[model samples]
Target: MTDPADRGAFIWYELITDDVAAARTFYRNVVGWEIAAEGQPLPTGGTYRMIARSDGGNAGGVLDMSAEMTAAGARPGWIGYVHHSDVDAAVKAVIDAGGAVHMPPMDMPGVGRMAMVADPQGATFYVMAPTPPEGDPDARSDVFDYAKAQHMRWNELWTTDPDAAVSLYRDLFGWTQEGAMPMGPMGDYKFIQHGGDGIGAIAKAQPGGEGSRWQYFAGVDDIDRACRAVTDSGGTLLGEPQQIPGGEYSAYAHDPSGATIGLVGPRKET
Candidate 1:
């Protein structure tokens, strides 16, 4: 909304879930978020769930997995949207850049135009042209800061080829590699920055692990406390808090519906 050419910047977040109500409750408790029905229903006759932060900022949404979507192999997971000035042009660029289109461009009555696509390595996300913008482009003052709780703060990509993944984004979103860190044997964890901010990072696909995909991180108040809440609210914590560079901690989890999400927070002192 603020800048149309802000390519490669994550503009919106959406979770396509098998159980919208369960997701609504689980996330509301785990992240202190409040979700409600989108005032208007989609052209398909179903409504989209709006995720709202306590501060009145929008984190993203939860779309009900229609029977058709499930039958067609659309599973439960979160998908991030990239800001693009032209939806059709974005899809074309994705194709020319070696990505595949999962869904063709479709116009939402009120939202804007968008299409779903996967990188050459098969990591999927939306390429969207929101006629009027979606969420707070400046959702966080500093995405590198992990203390901005209850908002969609960061995105991470797991790909088979990190360089190619970074290249595709460079072509699609004008993204640049800010820097990278050695992940020991898994290769470099390459950071992706767009429009002068660190939006997310890319890393090699883990061995015998989940396939290539984009995982979004929502910032919360405390790592220990959120871990407890995640389980208490019917979600599964992936493991213990992972300390990132600069003293911040992050972790991953599986929501009740099996969507993998990430968490960024300050570590609780013992």
Candidate 2:
């Protein structure tokens, strides 16, 4: 059985891309992550590269999408993995709530059971019942820590139907819709809370945007330098870094593989 305390936590993050080598170089230079030189061989096929922070903690991973996966409509993007007590049960709940399954529940030798599912608005993410390694029975994942640099600091969802999307996530993961900030005509940016902390927000999708999707922000030491690195490393920033409530700056960019990513940090004078 899965622990109740572990439910609804963002335990893992992954970047699925076609050009693994280029992505390795791009993210290494931009986010300062230490990606594994060689990926760990998967039982089914191909490899999965583990990302680590400067402190030697696991941050996330890079998945080299198989031809079959791409042919089935998979695209390059960052997806968050939410921990659930039961992978199978979670998939069912999603289906019952108007969500669609992208991949049925499956187990990997060491990774634990997981499945891919999309929300009613077509935003995709993973639900997993992770398998802790031997001797670490109570291991907790810190991949989504907001206070740690190089870790995922925010999980924003821009959806076509904000009200329905918020309700679906609240039912599935026990997340709460706390307070919100008005965004003029775009609509309110509603904050999401889980485990007693503000994890991210759900906002109405703007016209001409990517429709509906989740965009995670990785914390860095310097926002200006990080934005510069994005362009220098073959990625393009969506816009200038904008200051947020906490006085830090956040910027979004498209990696070389056309995968969207966000960065958050302080602005240092050049």
Candidate 3:
């Protein structure tokens, strides 16, 4: 019975790759997007290549990783789904803050109530709540809807210790403190909000940083033409395109099977 406009993030992203036709020709010649293979079914099995959204919707799904799932190492990233109303109390507030319950709140019979966390710096993600989908999922009735891809607003956290991951997500999602920015060479970023709802930001990890991860901002209208279409589709830009603090305009890249992704744009009217 969940169809209040399909709630939020009907399906934001999945992308766990091995090849799938060169990751759908490298995100369709870099983010102008277009790869709707239509038949989704690969958590580790067979078909999966529905990353459509050049106004086609269904904005995510691309798997091709089974060498026994990357020899059980499972890295080829991309995982972000947060529209939780209560995926078992957000997996018990990510195991009461120490965060580690990698999958313990299942129930996808219809399509909702998921759970898979990590956060004490292992940094995985997934905590949704969108069910009741069987026959109106899409096709110009356009019911799956995420507004048109790139709808996660923001969600960043590159940490080694941004004040203990911003006090462990501000006491597990009560969130606050929306200030602080000096990402000059990645020194101080800390900008978390929730009740005020800018939806994300938190930084520090850089001295060999490759630990914490959960970065997705996506919006896009045109930030230097999507950072030159993520460097003409090869993708790998990490920095050198900034202007943060709300007027927006981000860059940070990856996706040619690297999978980090961030490309905001718009929102500069102050």
The best candidate in terms of lDDT: 2
Can you write out model 3's per-residue Cα lDDT over 74-136, one digit (the tens) per residue?
867778775555778767867777778866887766666788788777778786776645675
Clashes of 3: 0
| lDDT (10s digit) by residue, model 1, range 19-127 | 8777878888777888784434566634587788887777787788777778888889999888787889988877887789988999876577889988888899898
Q: In model 2, state the lDDT of residue 254.
A: 94
Steric overlap count per candidate: 0, 0, 0
C-alpha lDDT values of all predictions: 0.80, 0.90, 0.65
* Superposition TM-score, candidate 3 onto the true structure: 0.29
Give the range of the ten consecutive residues with the poorest summed lDDT in model 3. 139-148
RMSD of 1: 3.0
- Candidate 3, clashing residue pairs? none
lDDT of 2 by residue, 1-270 (tens): 267988899999999888888888888888889888888766555579999898989899998888777888878999999999799999999898888998899997777999999998889999999999777888899999876679999999999999998898898899999999999999999999997799999999888989888999999989888888898988899999999998889999999999999999888875
> CA RMSD for every model?
3.0, 1.4, 17.4
Top-TM-score candidate index: 2
